[model samples]
Target: MSRESFDLDIRIDPERQRVAKQRAREGRRLMLLELGVAAALVLGFLASGASRRLKAALLGAGLASPWLLVGAYLGLVLVGYALAMAPLGWWSGYVRAHHYGLSTQTLRLWLADEAKSLALSLVFGIAAGEVIYWLLRTYPDTWWIWGSTFLAAASVLLGFVAPVLILPLFNTLTPLDDEELVARIRRLAERTGRRVAGVYTIDLSARTTAANAMFMGLGRTQRIALGDTLYSQYTPDEIETIVAHELGHQVHHDLYQGLALQTALLVGALYLAHLFLRWGVARFGFAGPGDVAALPLVALAVGLFSLVTMPLANAHSRWRERLADRFSLQATGNGAALARAMTRLANQNLSEIDPPRWAVWLLYSHPPLAERIALGSEAPA
Candidate 1:
């Protein structure tokens, strides 16, 4: 397609844009609602003396070891939290997606996925809680520093393993059989002075129609993964542009940059949590920072900290996304194709071309669709 042939105005469907806006709005509403519910639950647990009672009951049951006590407390807390949140999870994850005609998952499949997610969360959450409480007990005054460091290390470790260990649990990933396309992508990587382990297609169509492409893993594990919906629907040039964008993330080391950002945020949040714990000790008569009953305070602090900092993190993310978009245009030298691809993606993925400015400021992690399309249209080939 010629540069002049791609008309930005004509490519957008008005009805689709309307649906996109509604979906986006509702999605954000659901997120905020979930957060509110979580905060309320934590506060209720503390206010009602439920957390204290639970900890006391466990201790009275002859759970003598601190490790065992922490484990049991976290397990019960996590289970209770999960049970409380399950209704909202169903509404947001399953019902809402189905209502929007976005989800292909049946109730059974959705439940199965939720089960997997809950199991993973329990394992990780309990493990992290144990380590954290241990640190609190051992280093009451400076546990935040050590805790943040451990959390930072864990984040990076997850980054390296998630693509291989975690992702495969949810979706089947197999090598893309399109030999010609694979070669084209390899050449694209080569042109950027990089190599990929392989090109794979993920089973996105099984769950949702949202098209996406990503560079997965780090170092020797690095590979390109194209959503099946993307591979089946988009043209080679369009896919090339999308893959180029993912490559930009790799080339710019955005993953490492993100980890660094996360480490900073963790330190800040943990410090805030420490302060909250100290206040809980004074106000709520908690034993100390190591008190299991004060866990809710730690959660409330960390959650509030994350909620407050979300906009700043999102702004940083938007900057990276803009850089990636620029890289895609420069690397592919197919601005027209990129524009067309974004147009199709907006429609297919139900993205609002020009979202409200407030949403852009507070929620968006990428430049709005209209801006990306314009960038592609204006790029010099």
Candidate 2:
């Protein structure tokens, strides 16, 4: 939001720092609020003996038809989750962006987007849950392996289609009109030996001031996209550094690596879910994992697993991110450009330049800005 603060020197803006600290505080609150709400829903459902009633209600609602049953169950679950998450979603997803002067959305527009998201999630989640529950019902003993494999495939499929299908639902994607930057990007791609399909710009200024670029899609959909915010707020050299960094991700096959690692994590998480479900259904006197009523328990299992694994995942991510930084430096052979770009990006995004060590260990998926800046200034081999 403060384009005037784009300075190469590491000068601190007191006002921006104040807002960033406030944002951080509020962000922590949002995270804790979300976690508490999720846990409360899970525990409250379990404790209030509501699960059985919901299951029975679904049975009656779906008594005459199979589609009716799945529809009723899925509808109830999705709507319930949406209702529970709405307040926090507004506070974090909508209000916070406005508070930070990052958002350009009206409340009505934001709510409409939220509704569309809920609808999309409901459709896909129900479809997937139906098959997953069917697997659990048919192969209780070995469902974890099959379910995980299915999920891994689904994840890949989502990534493949997301750029082409889902992205357009929220924002308009258009070609960047800056020929000079586009040419530089093409040259960078050629230097990296990657044939990027095209470079496009997403209309991010309509929604937020956050600057971002990424290499997404697979095969035909593979291309680089820069948020419009980036171009408006950054110089050609800075954008080039971001392009090189993202291209480094593609050259290193980080996407596939990330997918594979996530799949591995899913397999383990699902296996643990199986164990938890087995113990839970017996102890809590609930229906089997296939029952819609027990979905909350499933969520709990996966959620807890992710929480426990957060630090490890963050560490791996930060390591790979550093590798990407080093790759960018090597490819560009302009450490000063990279460092200055990194600095401007941090200032533009109002990123916490140097977060607490413990917070970085627990939740950060990328290395601290200071560390990344240092990488650009690393001595040549």
Candidate 3:
């Protein structure tokens, strides 16, 4: 190739590359710190007499008997969910978003939002647990297969109902009001051969600061939900890029794939749980099978199992996210814009720009922002 031709083909920038490297390092470091914190919390919960108190309470409540144990277990889980919701919403969803200036909602609104979430969680968790319990009793030898089937069905059913039922409880949904922008997005969807569903705006700022857009449901109820913050904060082009990313997920069948993977994982976990339950009951002084007093012991075993599998699960999710990023770039034809959007999102969310490699391996569902930006900027090869 001639010198001019070579120059035309190359779009490399050393300064951008250097910045990307620094961001990657920082991302890794931050991930490590987060993982350490999570581990410490888990250990503290086990060591601070909380686990023992729970076990004692269950036992004293007649949970040691197989018949009454399920009720006891359910009660414990309800209390745990209630206690955890406030801190989880504040730290994971609210405070971090506010710290990064992404959230616009007041504290009262945020708490109210969390209250709705708690209600939803309680309903779903109890229902799912009861289904599992029933499956174990009815199909002891084939619970894994039946359990997977049930879980998959439940996921699809929930996906359809959530937007219409659970979501409206937390935020008001209104039709998108921008006619011109809606027209442009419709054109983009048409050009990409994607089915254009109704576009709706969610009052997300009423509860939290993080901005997002999503594609929800399947078939007729399938619609696009754009957070109010995304509409107000991002320019039209940026919003288009975000919408394209969500469309990419749909195009790539990510939702179905994710559900299938989760079902398989759950089946495997339950199989192992069955095996462990046998030995656990023998050693832990609990009645077999439905003994509620042993719920804490079962949870402890599952927690340890999940901790060991964390890195593998994180890697799988990161890979899927990277694929979605590529699909967004291809669909939008706005690679640089997507990169800018990603950076803005990271900055706005106070996401650790740099985290340790070990931390990313253990905790992150998305690749480091630096990696995503680089991929966004790179030319197709």
Candidate 4:
């Protein structure tokens, strides 16, 4: 059906719409399934007394140091969860994506990507587990506060380093070769009174057909990445509108604001986890809050807290996205271009034009397409 906005007419392909709805349903189900699996793993470990037995076994194996014991226990649990979840990950990320004509990678390439992701997870997971356990032992009275602060700082550090250190592990990134396009983007950033270090194109086409662009990093590390898929398809004007929205993030200092919000939430979640750890020492027969056996309780507490608070986080994110949209219009003074860009994005990305209200509350980090289009129409020319 052809949908009319004040400045543009956009058509939603009926078949694509049906496919998009189907994909959305499957994606939700997969999310629920992943959550269910995680909850079950943690709960089963606690209820079955498996955590206690595993810790005992590790101690018996002469891992007498608390740090070593905790590290080993966490490593085993991480491997077990990954093994259990691997099949589902493959299905959702590979099989289902391919079925929907979204994925472009061969199975081998997909598996390689998964392997790299798992390796990164295991490395970080084990390290974080070690630090967290150390904090639990050393700062038993206020580990939550200390741990949350450390994690927040670590998150900021990661943001600074990821565009350089971490992202290259997954895909190739090169300075965008188009001189005209680069100049245009740099000019857009200047218009917003900010400057990006560089404009780069990411090899997203190596993995999927979906189009995207992002403004990432902090300080000198700050840069913009346009997916090759988007670069190949979108016109310069449409691309500029997208870049303006990203520059909006920079101009508004949304990155720092978002980190602050995240830090606040992390404190809340860890505080909840700390309480659960104390309660678990009695309820689950753990020796103390520092006992490695009580790790499952921590996981359960943190996961549940995140699930409950996701809506609030998403609501804040949507607000920021709206501000960026308005910024894009104001900076570019071209609402029609934004509207057209959004129309293309909807079709190319298989975005659902009119998702349900509940989904928006729970899941959406940006306003729905119709709302964005209406906002564009109402923007000053």
TM-scores, in order shown?
0.95, 0.93, 0.77, 0.95
lDDT of 2 by residue, 139-250 (tens): 9889999999999999899889999899889977788778788888888878888676577888888888887787788767777788888867776777788888888887
RMSD (CA, Å), candidate 4 to true, equals: 3.6
Candidate 3 off by > 4 Å: 1-69, 84-102, 138-141
Best by lDDT: 1
Report the lDDT tens digits of candidate 4 across residue range 167-207.
99988888888877778877776776655557788989988
How many collisions per candidate? 0, 0, 14, 0
Q: lDDT tens string, model 3, 1-381?
A: 001111112333445445544644654565466556555554554446464566577778776653345555665666664674446446645675565455677888777866677777667766776776666666756765776688779988987787788777777779888877788778778877867767888887665555678878765667788887667766676677777777777777777777777777766676677776677667655545444444454455556667777787788888888887877787778877677666656554445545667668877888887687677667452
Cα lDDT, model 2, residue 364: 93
Give the range of the ten consecutive residues with the poorest summed lDDT in model 4.
Answer: 1-10
- CA lDDT of 222 in candidate 2? 75
3 or 4: which has the higher lDDT?
A: 4
Residue 297's C-alpha lDDT in candidate 2? Answer: 74
Residue pairs in candidate 1 whose N, alpha carbon or C atoms collide under 3 angstroms? none
Question: Any runs in candidate 2 off by more than 4 Å, and if so which?
Answer: 1-10, 64-67, 377-381
Residue 92's lDDT within candidate 1 is 92
Per-residue CA lDDT of model 1 for 98-121, tens digit only, reads 888878998999988988998898
Model 4 alpha-carbon drift over 4 Å, by segment: 1-10
Q: lDDT order of candidates, best first?
A: 1, 4, 2, 3
